[model samples]
Target: MDSIQMFLANCNLSVSQAMRKIDSNSHGILFLVDDNNLLVGCVTDGDIRRYLLSGGGMSDVVARASNQKPKVARSLAEAIKLYHNRDYVVIPIINNQGIVIDMYMGEGVKDKKYSPLHLPVVINAGGKGTRLDPFTRVLPKPLIPVGDLPIIELIMQEYQSYSCDEFHIIVNYKRELMKAYFADNEANYNITWYDEEKPLGTGGGLSLLRGKLKSTFFFANCDALLTANYESMLKFHKDNGNVITMICAYKNINIPYGVVEMGENGVITDMKEKPLISFLTNTGIYIVEPEVIDDIGDEEAIGFPDIIEREKQKGKKVAVFPVSENDWMDMGQLPELEKMRKKLFGE
Candidate 1:
């Protein structure tokens, strides 16, 4: 029996899907998928690198590697040698007719836990934050004190909990101060800086970061806060290969008075009192692919929603991941910040 069959119970992925797993992992050589407890196909590092070199997009299927024969090993030493020479991280022990009996993974597989890849988060912190009133007169929105810690740090900590450390923070106003703050209190993480000489509209600031960032990185309005599991979200993004993914929260509004729905013939067909309406408002968070950022115009203040519309015109894949109403928090307004403080630390 091969190790691939064992992983079938663990990963719950098809052979075709398992093969692509090597792309994200550096040490892994190949991934194995099973079909009804039977060996199906294998994926190798070479297969993924070739696909990228060919300019094959993320949406392109990696089904080609499924036809190749997997390297077999009888003992652990033989498997280790095969893994080292061929650079295959996982070797499946199989019998005739491609039946997976057992599987083996490289070292650290037992120690390191698996974290899901969903979306990379990019936080835009460049704005002057005129909406924040007196706070903007002194500190940047990211630097504003939420409770005991700065708001940006809290935001980063939230994403960090999900093992997302790849961050890109757009800086314009007080760029020096922001950089200094981060440098002084360095958190062992990777954060690429995007500086704007002049004010660039929310969408325009991202134009400079097109190629420097990952193919898909989430964009968040610095001042906004929300509670959600990033691991699950990124898994959804990869599974769908979405070009743009929005994290939305539902907002409910109550009508104070009765409302009537009238027909064209001046007849009131329906009447409801104090109706509670629900809407999926933008939560100021987005998971955007690199190709989408390429369309951003240079040195202008363009909004991301406009870019989304453009992608839609071109028939690109744009999606939304919704969160519960209580799980989301907006710090745009002063009162909202107070409410968030209480929610975060309790009154």
Candidate 2:
């Protein structure tokens, strides 16, 4: 399919198909058209999310989640003007017949630059990755290759795009190999090495950098990759007076069988077949203040979630920043790693 066709979805297409099109397209938008190739509506990732939140299922038609009245240019001149206005990255030009004839994609739209964040990133890469089995027996989880780059490098590069260059990595299992891999590589990432003599649970590793990180930093697990907007997340974190902002993903799970709702006396109140359920799941990424490190004791093996709960119990501001399920990829296990590789490299 051509580049433009990838962004075009039929109005009768399933929500799942529209979602795939949106994910594969350069722009986060899908243009919905009718059987006669007439413009019907526009669907974005946000629209699908809101639809899911409103109990819309994946089998529903794309039209139900799309904007019936969308901003479109009637002529080439108008499309150019709209594109130049910086209000949109791409403008669809429809003829009088209501058919999309062409599109005006602004220059650098696909390669848009983001402002630098200039924040330190703390990555917990010390896990033995027992779930990966024999592979973990040879290599650490962070050293596992997602594509050409290892998972740790990929994580660092993602943050580097937002100009977050400094990285503080905590390593324990296969620590020497992790350190040696970075030492031999030519990628000039600003890295500070922290060693754990023994395994420390996720949050416990942060204790090694008690005096290192004096400012706010990005904390992430080496096994997960999140494509959410870091700048927006940071803004929300600071605006809400949060001590730690956990990034969570809204996961939608579809049940295959009919679920009968039972009330008092075993009376069936309602029945819905293959209902789609949405839940907010932790993505293992967080924006943390330096002060939180004080709560973690040295050589302690506490998980990160435990720390968050403790802070909440103490009445500290702990917030959650939500992202779509598609934005977060957990690569801790074999199946998930393969899925993440295909998603990242389109294999």
Candidate 3:
């Protein structure tokens, strides 16, 4: 595809299609145009996410999630000036008729760097990845390759970009292999190892660091990688006075075929064809306070979700931060692993 086509999408395109375009373009934006090739709006990953969070469906048209009035340049000189002045990664040059004639990409747009977060990150890497099957039989899921680096390393790097340097990894299944891989790597990462003697569910492993984390820290699953804004999530957690802030993704599942709703006496009351259902699902990432560690009992086989529920029961502040479906990468299953690899490395 040509450069211009890569970032252009018809207004009638589905939200999912527009998401794919934004992901592949690497500019994190898409120009929505009408049938006449006139610019109608601008769509970004954040725009789609907000649409989904607000009950928008994946099959909804791109126009429903796009900015009706986007910042634009009228000419090449104006585009260049706007690009540097606003530090924009990409800007569309439009004519008097609002038709996009060209685009300007800022220098080093592809190599943008994020500010450091300097927060501690805790990764739960102790689970036996039964879903991945044969692959997990040899190497632990965390060590499984996602592009050039292991899944665990990629998860760590996501945090490192936010300047989160200190890592606390909880390991159990094939623990040595996980440690050896990190030890052999040239990239120096500061990590603290916590060994789980037996199979402990997600929240159980956290009990080991009851006193280690004096301040707020990030907790993530080894099989998941999220590209959402960590700073914003942290701010939300603190601002809300939440003890645990879970990160969730607004996922839309489109069910195929028509469904009939039966009433009394098997009477068909309603029928809808290929309806789309939206849900806010846990993305296995969190910003947690240190005191919550006391709520978990050592060696207890309880998942993190259950822990959150218990905290809620006690009236402790617990909240959820939602991200777009495209921001989350689930590497738990073989199919998802391949999908994540392709998404991250264009494999």
Pairs that clash in candidate 2:
none
Error of 3 at 68 (Å): 4.0
- Ranking 1 against 2 by TM-score, winner: 2
The runs of at least 3 residues in candidate 3 whose Cα sits more than 4 Å from the true structure, single-residue gaps closed, are: 1-26, 31-40, 48-67, 266-269
Kindly list the per-residue Cα lDDT of model 1 for residues 186-205, writing each as its tens digit: 57557788888888777788
TM-score of each: 0.64, 0.83, 0.86
Among residues 3 or more apart in sequence or in different chains, the pairs in candidate 3 whose N, CA or C atoms overlap within 3 Å are 116-162, 116-163, 117-162, 117-163, 118-163
Lowest-sum lDDT 10-residue window in model 1: 6-15
For candidate 1, give the lDDT.
0.68
Who wins the TM-score comparison?
Answer: 3
Weakest lDDT window of 10 consecutive positions for candidate 2: 106-115
Q: Write the per-residue lDDT of candidate 2 for residues 1-347, one digit (tens) a residue.
A: 37668778789988776776776674779999999999989998778766865788777898999999988999889988887777676688888999888877866545656779999999998888999988999999999999999988888989999999999999989999998899899997789999999888989999999899899999999999988778878987898899999998866678999999999999999999997765678999999999999999889999999999989998999988766677888988899999999999997
Candidate 2 local lDDT, residue 55? 80
Q: How would the candidate models be sorted by lDDT, starting from the highest?
A: 3, 2, 1
